[model samples]
Target: MIHTDVTEPQDFLVALGGNMPSEAGAPGDTLQAALAALAEAGADIRAVSAFYATPCFPAGAGPDYVNAAARIGAAMTPEAFLALLHRIEARFGRERVRRWGQRTLDLDLVACGDAVLPDADTFAAWRDLDPAAQMERAPETLVLPHPRLQDRAFVLVPLNDVAPEWRHPVLGRTVSEMLDALPAKSRAEVLRLP
Candidate 1:
C-alpha cells in the first residue's frame, strides 16, 4: 500500500543506526543497503549524512553502532511511512526484544513535516519524559519530531550533515542548536567514520 498518487507529500527525517551486523555485511554496509531499500520501496530520499561510529547506547547494550540520517519526501501519512520503515527493518532482521537493545538495523521516523503527531500535550508528555523513565517505558503511539531527538548527540551529530537548519516544530530549535546543546563530551563521542 505505497502511496503513489496523493495530495500530501510530506518531508520526512529518518535516523538510521545499527550495532549488530546483518546478512548484508557489517553495520555500515547494512545501513547503506537499507537506504537503497528505502529508495527501491518508494521513498524520495533527498539527502544522507555521513556515517558515524558511536558507542553503544546505555553504555553496554552491545557493540558500537554505525549511525546516519536521511531527509526524504513521500506521499504517505506518517503512520503508513512508519509501517514501511518497520517492514524494511524486518527485512534487515531487526528484532524488537527490548528497548535500546542492540539490533541488526533501526529506521526511526524522526519527523514528518511540521505535524505535531497525536497532539501537542501527548507529544509534550513524551518529549519532557526523563531518561530513567524513557528506559523503563515505551510509548504505545508515535510522537512527532521524535521526543528524544533533541537529546541524543549520536542522532544530531550525523543529522547535522543533512539537516542542520531543520527546526523542531515544538522546541523551536534547529538541529544545529540541539547538537550544540548536548554536552561537549556527548558530541565528541559520535566520531565520523572516514
Candidate 2:
C-alpha cells in the first residue's frame, strides 16, 4: 500500500475508463467529474490527458470506451487513494458487474511508485501466492510494467497524453516510445477528443 518513497508530493498516475454515457453531454464529462471528485477528496490534480475514445477490450459487448489519465499528488498511502477512487466511482453510479465490462466508471491504479510492482494481486491473493505456490500453481502475479502496458494502445495512448515522460522502470521506455512500438491496430481505434 505504501508504494512510493516520496512523501506528500509524490506524483502518481490514475487512469479512468468508461463508455459514453447514455445521458446527454460528452463521454469525457464522466472522467472530468470523477477527477473533480478526487480533488474534492483532497488529492491534488497535477495534470490530465485528453479523452481518448478506443475500442472495448475483449471485443464486443458495448461501444468504444472514453479513457483518460491523470497525475495526482496526494498525502495518503496507495490504499487510501484507492478508497477515494472507489468513493468517487460510487458517486458517479459505477456498478461492478463484469471484468472489463461496461460501466459508468472504472478507476484503475495503473502505477503507484517509480518502482514497478512484481505483485499486484489483491492483497490477500498476493500473500497467498507466495505461500500457496507449493500446493499448486498460484494465479499469475500482477506485476506492473503491467505486462500489457506496451501492447494496449488504450492504456498507452491516454497515458502518453498525460505522462509522456513517464519512464518504464524496467524497460526504460517513455510512454511515447512504447506507444510508437505498438502495432497500428493497437491504437488504430484510439481517437483524441476534439
Candidate 3:
C-alpha cells in the first residue's frame, strides 16, 4: 500500500528570548505578544512555559532577558514556520544586524519531533562547534534540535516546563536530562517570573 500521508502533524518547539523592550513595553511583554502572534499566524500552540528572567548572553551585551518555550503543532514546512517567526519578529522591530545581539524579540525554532534538519552530519558539525567559533559564526541554514540547546540553561530550563520528556532526535537526551546536566549555578540563573 502506498502511504500518501506518511507524515504526522509535528509539534515544533520554539524558544523565545529578548533583552530589549519594544512597543510592547518590556522583554516579558514582547514574549507574550509574540505568543499571541504565533497563535494568530496559524500555529496550534499546545503548550507554553512560564516567563523566565535570565541574564543576557555574553554577560553584559544588554539587559537581562525574558525567556520562554512553546510547543505548537504546525502543518507547514519548517522553513515556512521559521519565516512566519521572522515576520513576527520584524513586526516587533527585530533586526538581523548582529549575532546574539540584544533584540526586541527572538524566536528560535528549537526542534520538530524527530527530524534532523538539514542533515545529521551538518547538525553534528554545528553541535560540535567550538565556543569561539560559536561566538563568531552562525549557520547559514536551519539546524534541528538547535545545536546549542543541550548546553543552554536559559533555553533548557524553560523547555523543561513544556517538554521535559521530549527527547533529542539525535542526542537521545530528554529536556529534563539536559537541564539537569547543567552546572548548578547555570540552572539557578533561569528564574521564573510570576
Top model number, lDDT: 1
In model 2, the Cα lDDT at residue 176 comes to 95
Cα deviation in Å at residue 67, candidate 1? 0.3
Let me know the TM-score candidate 1 reaches against the reference structure: 0.96
Worst 10 residues of 1 by lDDT: 1-10
- How far residue 166's Cα lies from its native spot in candidate 3, in Å, is 0.3
Q: For candidate 3, write residues 1-194 as lDDT tens digits.
A: 11112255567899999999899879888988998888787678899999999999989898999999999887777777788889999999899897888999999999988889899999999999999899789999988979999999999999999999999989889999988899999999999899
* Per-model TM against the reference: 0.96, 0.78, 0.94
Model 3 — which ten-residue stretch has the worst lDDT?
1-10
Candidate 2 structure quality by residue, lDDT tens digits, 10-78: 567777888857232355788888887777766788888888888877678787889888888887656
RMSD of each: 1.3, 6.0, 3.8
Q: At residue 133, what lDDT does model 2 achieve?
A: 50
Residue-level lDDT of model 1, residues 1-194, one tens digit each, is: 36655576779999999999899999999999999998898788899999999999899779999999999888988888898999999999999999999999999999988889889999999988898999889888888979989989989998999999999999999999999999999999999999
Ranking by lDDT: 1, 3, 2
Off-target runs (Cα >4 Å) in candidate 2 are 1-7, 20-26, 118-147
Please provide the root mean square deviation of candidate 1 (C-alpha atoms, Å): 1.3
Q: Give lDDT for model 3.
A: 0.89
* lDDT agreement with native, every candidate: 0.91, 0.71, 0.89
